[model samples]
Target: MSRPAQYHLLSLPDGSWETVSCLASVIRCRATTPTVIVDVSAVERLTIDALAVLVRKAMRLRSAGGELLLAGPGPAIRKVIERTGTGPLLPDFYDSAAALRALGDDGRAWQRVELSEGESALFCEPAQSPYCRHRP
Candidate 1:
């Protein structure tokens, strides 16, 4: 089977400024594919520096022939993106399933994995067991 694309979850807590920069750098260094999925559901606020870092990282990913997909961005972050006129630079935005579908080769290969102990469901790459190292 083809390897699943790397997935990144960028949760923005109240003090995400420091965290976001570190995450962005990690993604830049570790990702082999140009495609990255940034999950921003946990973000409550975005600072200018954080936003700039995100934009720069996204651009760098694209220039390297990779794409960045954003998901779970809160209203605050959305507003920031709009106000800064950076929406165009953002890659496709979608909820979890949509994001996975967008990444799949056939657009029809994805599955939802129910978490153990009633945690939450995670989208899994088609034919791969959820939460497996190869499933991301």
Candidate 2:
């Protein structure tokens, strides 16, 4: 029998390299999964560094036969994704459920993950580098 497509709901923090790095780590952990829907509803601002991570990761995931999706980005953030040339790589959805539905899933059997700012610090390099030290 064919395996069911797996989905992860990753709720991101404010658009900072530190916090976004933690979110990136989580996505790395689930690299083999079929889909990851990032919840950006709470993020009022999105940094280019954070957007770069999403674009890079999304490209890698697509190459590996998986996909990374974004959900609930506000008008400003949405415009950024598009103008930055990442809109093609990272498809934006109205919400997590909408992303799931687009993938032909019921969108009910997904796992949700979130990381706080304190937890994100653990994923950053010492001295508060401009970027997370995660390679690949």
On TM-score, the leading prediction is 2
| Lowest-sum lDDT 10-residue window in model 2 | 116-125
lDDT (10s digit) by residue, model 2, range 58-108? 876676566788889899899898788888888998988888788776444
Tens-digit lDDT track for model 1 on 22-101? 66655544444555677777677889888888888788767666566777777888888999998877754656556777
Question: Number of backbone collisions per candidate, in order?
Answer: 2, 0
Score candidate 1 by lDDT. Answer: 0.61
Task: Judge candidate 2 at residue 94 and give its lDDT.
Answer: 91
